[model samples]
Target: MTAPEPGTDGQSVRPRMAQHYSVAPEPDAPEGYVAPGMPGAPVAGYDPAPDPAEPSAGRRRRRRRRRTGLAVAVSATAMLVGALAYGAALSRVQSSIGWLAIALAAAVAWPLGRIGGQNRTLPPLGALLSATGLLLGQLLGQTLRLHRLEGTPYGELLGDALRIWRADRHPVDLAFYGIALIGGFLLTRRTASTD
Candidate 1:
């Protein structure tokens, strides 16, 4: 019980025990001198060290991409099959009549395909062009059918169809709706993968 060492309020003073008896200074490194085996460190002329794991990284990346693509493709195909079944269920409405809906769907699909094809290495322009051609072909087919069905010419056919669909509430197949939805999903996934 010697006199308490002073702290802020004159408490007993005591030296804190040092954990280390002594400390050594780090070796002084010369300018640009790097220790051996350190990353980016120069040894003599600084030859590039080969990455031992690069090939494995690349393989794993490719495998991941393949799996993703396979999953997406399978899902899309399954959806397409389900949509076809819905179309079949509506078979009574005269699928010949329903081709109009198909045509409209194609028209919408082409521009979307064009957008999807942007800057692709081989340029998916071929797919876009096919979509456009299919849409136009559908239009022509409708025009021909219009002449056969209602004594209308190719010129006045579009106006008549518009009037019919607009005035008469024809039942639309939910499958086309499904196609459009799935197509959008496929487009987004494909774009993201490319990036």
Candidate 2:
């Protein structure tokens, strides 16, 4: 049979066929461009970029923030309630208790944030509401006190209470507002990126 096909050592060579069961590569792509994550070995100087959509095993997922409207509403409500509570307390105590109001406003911010389901925005809103509430509460207390005076006419106390802010001698009133503002600021401090 044509000299029986010369063998490697001058003997007859075997006639077995070659076999390949692995996945076939695309005919169009060049031989060197191997896809990532494949069993094929990685080629040098061609590291594939990590996919943005891929879920990394090493990193934590980021949490999205809550809406703003709910935050503001909750903060305002907390501030108002805190101020009213402080004012009512102040009226009974009947003294320059600005510090107490400041403390109350500051304390209310955390709960306000919690109510809004957000770490951001609510604290400042709460502080603002608290300060305003405190101021209003002070005016209310003043008006109530003036209502008890001997010759004060009805509805005149409002004007008198408004005028109190202008009085030069009433340092305590100014201090109340100032402390309220400062205290609000101090309470709403953001320690981390979350808030």
The candidate maximizing lDDT is 2
lDDT of each: 0.44, 0.61
| Candidate 1 local Cα displacement, residue 153, angstroms | 2.5
lDDT of 2 by residue, 1-195 (tens): 554678779765767567585986556877686677767868679858878997454443232233345545655666667766765665577566777776666655555544344455555666576678777777766666666654587487688866763462376767777777666655654321343
RMSD vs true structure, all candidates: 11.5, 12.9
Model 1 clashing residue pairs (backbone)? 4-12, 5-11, 5-12, 5-13
- Residue 76 in model 2: shift from native, Å? 1.6
TM per candidate: 0.31, 0.52
Instruction: Say which candidate scores most in TM-score.
Output: 2
